[model samples]
Target: MEEKFLKVTQEGHFFDKHKSVLIAVSGGKDSMNLLHLLYKYQDILDIRIGVAHVNHQQRRESAEEEVYIKEWSERRSIPFHVSYFEGTFSEEAARTMRYDFFAEVMKQHDYTALVTAHHADDQAETIFMRLIRGSRLAHLSGMRVVQPFASGELIRPLLPFPKSELMNVPHFEDESNYSSLYFRNRIRNDYLPLLVNENPQFTSALLHVGKESELLHQALRDLICHIDVTNLQDFQAQTVAVRYFLLQHYLEEFPELQLTRDQFDQVLNILEKRANYQHHLKGDYYLIKDYQRFAITKIQPKTDRQEEEYVIESEGVFQHGSFIFSLNEPLEQPDQIIYLQVHQPILLRGRKAGDRILLHSIHKKIRRYFIDQKIPQKLRDTAIVIEQEGKIYGIANMVASDLSKSAKNDIIKATLYIKMKE
Candidate 1:
């Protein structure tokens, strides 16, 4: 088993010499095996190891497992980090919380890699679950052996080995693994055993399926790697399959936005149909189509003061909503600029109901102008307008009405810069 471990690590290029890796130990059989093996081989691998554990606090043995793992790490003189969940969470939520804690530990402690003990059995189960749940091909392939995660790489050195091959080690077994409260537990305890009894090599067959699916998935990913999804013309030029994969790859960056097949198809359809379409996704996020480009943006929540006017009597620099106004000096990459001959105090504010701006001797409603210009509603809501003496002067970054750009020499020169969204 030790020789096989060395071979797997070597072939996978799991770690570089002299790099520090953080081990995710849960006091389970798999994680314990991984912790001990890495400790035993650290000298040969030329890597340092630290331990991290997250107590989900679901099972009765949770506290005992946390203590056991911490003591084990202390005995080996390895750095240890532990976090306890505040309350009971669903399985999905718990998994997310667990990884979030792991990521925090990695970032704070400067660990170069996060090593886990996911073996072939875990991979097989994951593939089976995803398949039954109707997932995309990429998701159905199960977990990757190594992927960029947190501050470094998330590596699973035991992926090639079956669970039966792991040597027996003293470890705590959480009873939750046998409970039906979790979908994975039900799959592992009930359905999987039945299938294995019927066909002894069923798990191996699923592993084979996972490997083939992953190979195809990687091929699709590589095919769309050169296509930029944000560039409308370039993205439209790709084949349909490539385009789908490109969108999938783009959404993968935002793990919080989960879309079903119908919703994903709707996005693709919106791209093909027209511009200026805003589709609300989960939370405050929206998929917006500008004239020629599209992007996912989170609309800022509205506040009571979002529409409040700022009285700028004489400004050196003033911030109103998302725009920064600089008086008499040029700013790098100003979104909009206009010269104003100030005879009265000017007001900087967002658009209000019944707002109209004078452009080329014609009055146009601010709302109509925005719609005609194909500006997204989210941007229009926060669009800053310059006003003086009960008349609208300009909508910053979109238009500077003829009234705002006066020819007078006694000028209050102003430049508008929009702040980058957080």
Candidate 2:
């Protein structure tokens, strides 16, 4: 395996030895093997390797994993990039965050490629799962050895071996992997076991299918690589594999967005003939087909505030990505409440360019307001703002410009209420 690794590493011809790499570690034996192997052959490979970890914070031991990985990197004098995410999220969401962090780290730190620990067993399981799900042959080819991701190459060199052969490196197992909640879990626990019981070489057989499918898939990619725009009328006449490959390439740009086999078929069918077709995708995006061409597009994010002095659209509850906003009359009990007056109309949304507000009759810029409040930059990008007329009613609980009390005669105070949904 080591010789094979070295042979491929040289034949691939990517290393000047000066170029650096980023390894995605999950505190598992497979990832640990990747780290250890890279270190073992670092001198010969002539490349630098850095480590990165995404703490999904899904399990009780997730923090421990982060610490373990971080300390291991530090001990080896390797650069480390780490991030934390809150709440239990879907595997798709977790994968998105992981890649997002990896990309950010690569761009910020100048890494050449991101390496992962996907191996032959993983590919086999993935192929079988896709098979049971009725996936097309091309789609069942399993993970690629190398692909462009986040402006850098995402390479997996361990696909030649399974976890049993990766190493005996010390690592922790994620208990959730043993759970029955996930389909992949069932595949691993039930399907793979049953197949292997019938024939111990079942995984090897699956891998063989993957290799053949991948060869055919690559051929389609090479053939279609020259075709710029797929004509709607002729798309259906093409081989099913060709159409599937086109959609697969289209989806590569957005790894977070995924389509099942049925969904993939539906997209192709809709694009081939259906006019005025639109499919809403996850994460505020959608696929729209115009005439002969189809493209993935983002939904224009809705905001309550359209322009200066926009009146409140309604006095009812308004929900944005993660925050909830509402308007109410001054209540008897108030906590974390900002006072506002019944001005023109009110609107709530994130801050925009050139957004200025008046607080205690003092003019303040929204950008400066977020900085002064010590709100993190990412959160500030989506900070909820309450605005009326040209003045800011509230800057996300920081400043609530009093607009209701125009004169001393007015006693009742209107209120703007905001809370982040958990």
- lDDT against the true structure, each candidate: 0.80, 0.73
Residues 1-422 of candidate 1 have per-residue lDDT tens digits of 98999987987778973288999998999999999899999988989999989988777888888888888889989999998877658877778888998899888988879999999899999999998899887787788998988888899999999899998989987777888978999899999999999999999899888889888877877776655566677778877877788888878867888898998998988877656677797787788775456677665567664668788776577766766777665666776676665456777887754466767766566767988889997788777788776666787778877776553334444433343222
lDDT of 2 by residue, 1-422 (tens): 66777777677764543378999999988898888888878788888899999888878999899999899899989998889876668877888788989999999998878999888888999999989988767667899887777767888888877877766888989999999888889999988999899999999999999899889877877887655433454565567766767778757666667777677677777777757677876667687665544566664554543323224555666555555566673323433465555544666656654355655655455666777878886667556676564455666545555443342235765665666665
| Model 1 lDDT, residue 372, Cα | 87
For all candidates, the clash counts are 0, 6
Total backbone clashes of candidate 1, pairs 3 or more residues apart or in separate chains? 0
Best by TM-score: 1
What TM-score number comes out for model 2? 0.60
- Residue 135 in model 1: shift from native, Å? 1.2
Q: Model 1, which residues run further than 4 Å from truth?
A: 58-60, 300-422
Per-candidate TM equals 0.69, 0.60
Candidate 2 displacement at residue 30 in angstroms: 0.6
